[model samples]
Target: MRLWQRTMIRLARSRTITDFMHASRLMRPFSSRFVGGGDAGQAVATAQELAGEGIAASLFYLGEYVDSEKLVRENVDALLKAIPAMAAAGLPLHVSVDPTQIGSVLSWSLCRENAFRLARAVAEVARGGSHPARPALMLDMEDAGVNRETLQLYFTLRENDLPAAVTIQSYLHRSLDDLRDLAAEGAFVRLVKGAFAESPAIAHTVRSARNASFKAAVDVLFSQRARERGVYPALGTHDHRMIDYAGMVAQANGWRRQDWEIEMLYGVRPGYQRRLVQQGFRVRLYLPFGRSWWPYSIRRVGETPRNLAFVLRSMAGAAG
Candidate 1:
């Protein structure tokens, strides 16, 4: 990673900094840009609006590395409620959850149980929606430290024949193998150019390297073998070049517009998202909502450190 990105990643992990940012309203404007809103209702409304323009949305309740079981249960219950509500609005009921926030830290068994529970709910909703795409309990791939457990949980979900998806971060050296393995299982995957900062020994340390890995990973995701297994890959990126590359690969594999999907943050690269949709590509907006937006927003800025300057300028403008 570049020095700035590394610094930003470290800053994102600082509890002291997180507390300060959450305590003040200075970050609210910045958070609002990325987060859909403070509740499921707002997220559903945003999805409803996007649906009018031929786009889909994923509802992500935001919390991670939660300290208490009470908070974990709250997150679980909130997601359970959000699923049907989104489906009821005629929107695709996709939800992303972080294992750490959902009892992984408290008890692996508890986490697994909750995940299976949510996946069952998703399966039921998906059967009723009749949307071409399946309703998925998307498991967000968090920091490398938590990845092993997250991935295991996803496999567990799939083993149960539940509706679910898993995210793969391309920066990690092991992702290509993981992608290949998941492909055989007919996994639904969202591929992300990873955002966490880690040592060069285990992760690509530069953007160019990360993008290179991302490209390689996409090949595995779009290969004929993956296609034969009913694997569906979602390219989660704002980089037009990468998106184009994926389109080319999908075409080479004889895949259609709806065979795979593209995911972008709700407010990031709006025009690019629409252009893809116009060209007959499936798109899903990653819409996060909750009272606690600090971690998610910080990760966004950390993913691209230059965003920090934009946030600072916005805060300054608000002050003036």
Candidate 2:
């Protein structure tokens, strides 16, 4: 890591800093941008508000890397609980799951099994299209380490004919080939310029490289056969330039406005998100909730260190 990046991570990891933000109501104004709350009710309610505003949502419970089967079961139960309320509200909601949150510490077989079980449940709900209220489930991508198992489980569902989506980060070098292969077979791709910290051997560190790689991957996703696999690309970013580029790609390819969606983190760039929605583009807000917000919020700040200054300013009542 560069000297500045390393320093930023250290600042983000400081217990004093994290604890204060977690304990203070002063931070709520900023936290409200990204995290719904630490509970299902708050998250669902927030999602409904967004739906009312013509924004779609992907509800993510904020927790990961659970070591016990019991905790894993609880996570599954949480998602199961979320389904009915989201359904009843007629909200545009998608269920996002991280397998590590369920059973990463368990045996590998058990971990895969837990993911499969979750996928099956989501499949069951989605296949209930007759109900007209079921939400789509997306298997979130973890660090490069979990990519293989993630793909295996995703393909298993494909074989079983379970309809689902997978997120792929652009930072990893191998994703170029991965995108081509997956796009060939058909998959819904959520393209994010990744947020995790990783060693240089596995991930590109320079913003330029990451941007180039991400754009290349986007090109692959928009290939001729994309729409056949329901490959409506979800551009998971807040950068205006990248959003403009996606618009050009859509126009060049003659893609319907519905064929692509812009996704933004709940608390970042609200004005930009609103403007895009007003322009008739589908917008999906990543609504993350739960007590696990601390770690997730830290990662977000670490991803863009300038955001740390913004958070501190928010704590000081300086920014909205």
Candidate 3:
């Protein structure tokens, strides 16, 4: 990782910095650009708006690394409420949850139970036919420390026939193998260029290598074997090169736009997302909400310092 990205990641982890940013009036506008609102209602509204514009959404209530069972249950209950609300709004939404937020830090057993509870709630909502299609319950991948546990929880969800999707980060050396394994199980997956700062020992530290790895991973997802196994791939990226590469692969394989989906963050590259949607591609917006927006926003900025320009522009507009 670049020095600034490493520094930003460290800053994102500091409680004092997070607290200060959250408390600052100036951070509100900046935060609004990324987070939908501080509650589920706003998230659902955002999904509704996107639906009107021919886009789907993935809603995430962002808080993580829960240490208490009470907190974990609260998160699951929040999702349980959000699922029905989205269904009521008639939005086909993907609900994302961090395994740690559910219970990874407490114990694997606890995480599995909480994850199953959330997954079951989502499945029940889908059965009612309130959504356009069966909504997906996606497991967001965190740092390397919890990667194994996260994958295990995802597998368990799939074993029980839950509509679960897992994220694979291209920066990780092991992701290609993991993608193949998941494909064999007919798992749905979202592929991302990783965000967390990791040691060179475990992850690709070179940008060129990471990009190459990302392309290679995409190739595996689009391959005939993956298709035969019924693996659904969602490409989560804003890079034009990667997006074009995905389009090329789809065309060459005679895959229709609906065969796979393109996923992008809510705030980043809005115009690009719209263009893809206009071209008849399936697009899903990753919309994160809740009071835990501070850490999440900081981490996003840490991943790409260019995002700081958005904050600056928001601040300037407020000042003017």
The lDDT leader among the candidates is 1
lDDT of 1 by residue, 1-320 (tens): 36666777666667898888877766678778888988988888888999999999999898888869899988998898899888888887789988887888888898899899999998888887576467899999987887888889899888888888999999999999899989999999999998776788889987788889999999999998899999989999999999999999999998887899999997787888898888889999999988788777877877775677868976886677
Give all candidates' CA lDDT scores.
0.86, 0.75, 0.85
**Stronger candidate by TM-score (1 vs 2):** 1
TM-score of 3: 0.96
TM-score of each model, paired residue for residue: 0.95, 0.88, 0.96
Query: Across residues 1-320, which tens digit of lDDT does each residue of candidate 3 receive?
Result: 46777787777667799889888887789889988878999889888898999999988887787788888887888788888899899888479999888888888888888888888888888888856744789999999998888898888888899888999998998999999898887778999999887888888979898899999998888887777787888999999899899888767766677778999998998998999989898999899988877778877888888898988988788777
Least accurate 10 contiguous residues by lDDT in model 3: 127-136
What clash count goes with each model?
Answer: 1, 2, 0
**Candidate 2 lDDT tens digits, 257-283:** 787888888888788889999999999
- On lDDT, the stronger of 1 and 3 is 1
Point out where model 2 deviates above 4 Å: 1-30, 127-134, 317-320
Enumerate residue pairs that collide in model 3: none
Candidate achieving higher lDDT, 1 or 2: 1
Question: What is the lDDT for 213 in model 2?
Answer: 82
Error of 3 at 179 (Å): 0.9
**lDDT at position 59, candidate 3:** 88
